[model samples]
Target: MSPKKATEAPLTRYRQTFSGKGSFGEYLDVSRRFGKDKEWGVRINTELLNGNTAINSNDMEAQGIFANIDHRDKKSNTNLLVGYRHLNIEGGARWFSLKAAAIGKEITKVPSAPEASKNYGFDGLAKESEGYIIALNHEQKMNADWKWFLNAGMNSNKLQRNIIGASSNFVIINDKGDVSNNLMSTQTVTKNYYAQLGINGNIKTGAVNHDVTLALDKAWHSIEGAKNMYNNGSMGSVSGNIYSGLQGNNVWYPSIETGLSSKDQYWGISLADTVKYKKAQLLLGVHKHNASVDSYNKITGRVTQTVGSDALCPTYGFVYQPDEHTSLYASHSENFDKGTIVASKYANAGEVLNPAKTKQNEIGFKYANAGFLTSLGIFNIKQANNIDVYKGSDMYLQQDGEQEYQGIELSVNGKLADKWNFMGGLMYLDATQNKTQNGTNDGKTVNGAAKWNAVAVLEYNPDEKFSIVGRAMYTGKADIYNEQLQTPSYMTYDLGVNYKTAFNKTPVTLTAMCYNLTDKNYWTAYGNNLILSSPRTLMLSATFDI
Candidate 1:
């Protein structure tokens, strides 16, 4: 290839095809060109889910297609893309059974004794959504000293929440009051539309460069929803014996003083700039965000609650390169979130929350050699008074309420030798809830905050057609439920192999994986309840390219 052709190769278009099958599902992907100058192309993908190892069922189907138009070599380079997707999910209700132990109470795994899992509330609940997106990107290189680009996109989606059937011994208790057999068969619909536009460019000076970008985005969403709670044939209170179940019951939906629907809207704008020189670079960014929600009382045709807020956030950073192979960097950044709506199990179910924010600072240094990279860093993140509806009443208030995570992270990646490659990282975090509330919970370690987390993976390829890989992971102890419960640290290992060969002049690859090789039983994440990690399982996959 000539110099110019070699440099432009990265920007050229190419065709791709792949198909694979595994325990989770089967998938097919394809992208090709068709049109004059090969300016137009299309991509298609489809995947179906049918198996889950947790004894819980996983059933779903996802499919997507996209088309693109390119004008990259023109004076005014441009690209346009449009796509559509459909996703459906159903099944997977592995409810924990409450039981009495010799010492106290315990939550048992899915049972086979009574011979049934009673957690499938309102039977076969499913979620289905259809989404569409359109985007356009344009760029211009007016001269060697300057370049600019513009990007715009729009996305829209419709969703359906479905519920049908009944379960035995249905009882869901959270921060809210006891909800017994209230989750019945019901359905809801939601619609959302989003749009964004951004413009960016860079200008070169004598020995420096200045780059800047501006972006604006907006979203509109609405929902027509209801939660159904119904009694089985006969429902009544437990006889103080969890082993025995309820006999009689009443089923009905709890009526709010007024029927209500949820609607929300958001808008945001951001600006960023960077200055780069031979040995150093400085960066700055800022964002202004605003959002509002309306709880429309359908019965009275009046808006019951109006919640909204606006805020501004900023970030700054600096990087210094001592040489071509090493760099030192420091940064301060901010995060702004609109927050999620509470689930029906909470007292504030379906209620809108004020925005949650966090500020973070970090310093790090990196070194790179031929085909290898290593980095080490330390950082702290402070979250503003956040809200976890599961922990408090309709409103969870912990003033000054501060939880902070301070940690050190190290990572290494790339080829270790001629026939070997590896990548891994280790992180140690001292997470604390400080100065947030009364001394009662002050200085306590945050629940689910693992003290240590580490992961490593290595791969060896003796030849061009075969490879073997191994991975190891470890985690430290953590507190749960405000430190009421504790979880022990755990480690796991995984081994895998891949082989590539030609079949009938077509390339084919096979992969086999053994996860949790020790078959260790451990807790993964703790929230409203204990989440169990996957047991030792084996998976095999095959892929073909045409």
Candidate 2:
């Protein structure tokens, strides 16, 4: 039982990078335990305007920090781990732009026109968010075949936005050339706090593994906003029948508003079992979730609004490995998009709704050999009770509709030669809104689902000291709106080089990365009459290890 000979020494590595835009930055670190068999590390990341295509006046910044610690003792059946994370976001498009077809009329993008000498107040809104989270977890082995774990965490967020400029201008011009404008402005602030507790365990017997988890969570949110002015000097009035050649006006005034906040409590339990025998494995699971939101409406001056729902989700899957080099699998699962709990509480009674639900099925196969590995998968998803904005309403509502998305994905990764390695994947999607109320969207396509997408990378490592890499990506045409407005597809490329050597007996590494090498114009997401994408940029970094 004497201690074994030491085979490896502790190692530490550090890296930092600065990009051309001064917004894109990165840091990395690696560490290993020296004596106590404990390891801890952290990573810091920041990206600015990575691919946002908003006009020059618009800007964005993001920062993230992640840290983890792990400790283990061979004598005890217990272990402890802790994690912390922080994320911050600021800036974005403030003012919308108009499309070519909607030039003459005040459409989605046009704001109130500025006067010659008066301040237009046309500045776009600025958003700021701060979040802090911490998690503590513990694991215990109850027996040779049973293990259990418990985790608890808390998170708090402060979100505020300064909205300048008038409200959106929704103007329509009839054949007779009459014009009208609707203008308004407001500022909003929201704060949220969340706490969660969960416990899970697994038991192994023969060829079957049983797993179970139960969790409870609570969230509190506060929202405050002032509607300073209404359109066309209208105050304390609500617009009605404002479309179809009818003119309606509303006037809203700024007032010190304090409404009763909203709170939500949720609890869920899940059980899963996996049976593995021979080359075949089967997994089955079911989950039950219950949630409730309660709030007091200032207008009503009473705590009388409450919304609650319960749902059960089931999943099943099977995998067969016919040989060491090939395998096939299929799975079916249900996913839920929990509706905004706070929003439902403040809205009018009978307007609140439960979360949307999605059913998904996927089948895939994989093949691997000494020099090649590949996988192909086909998946379909159907969603119901989607949340969409009503055409003329300022409030959000849920629709009893269904949408379908089917897609195929293919991927490969392997070494082509002693010094060359490659990895790539391709995805194709056919997304459509299958059914909708009023039949207005019966044949419409879903936005943001590109018909085709692909990425490939090649890396050459001739020796340990020097290496090079190149990457390319292609995104095919995608519908910009549910009505099938299409945006053109695009392609982009990237390249990188790295050198590692010993300086004064200490290892040093230098890297240079160039992204969007071709500087192509590509849109990531478009809506609300705005388009965003990123241009090419270069980044360089150096690392030291001991």
Clash totals for all models, in order?
A: 11, 9
Segments of candidate 1 deviating more than 4 angstroms: 1-24, 34-36, 51-71, 76-91, 94-190, 227-260, 298-301, 385-400, 435-439
- lDDT by residue (256-352, candidate 2, tens digit) is 3334445556667676777677798888888788777665554454555677777898999999999999999999999655554433212232233
Give lDDT per model, in order: 0.61, 0.56
lDDT for model 1 comes to: 0.61
> Model 1, 1-546: lDDT tens per residue?
000111211232222222122236566555555545555444545445443433334455666666555555545667677777887766533332222121122332321122122123223345567777777777777665455666666666655443322322233232121233323333345666666667677877888888988888888877654433222323222221112232223333333222346778899999998999989999999989998888765445577677887789899999999999999999999977664554433444565555677899999999999998999999999875443432321322223466789999999999999999999999999887776546666777775788899999999999999999999999887765556555678899999999988779767788888888876766554432334455566777777776
lDDT of 2 at 527: 35
Which pairs of residues collide in model 2?
51-533, 51-534, 52-533, 53-532, 53-533, 167-184, 234-251, 235-251, 236-251
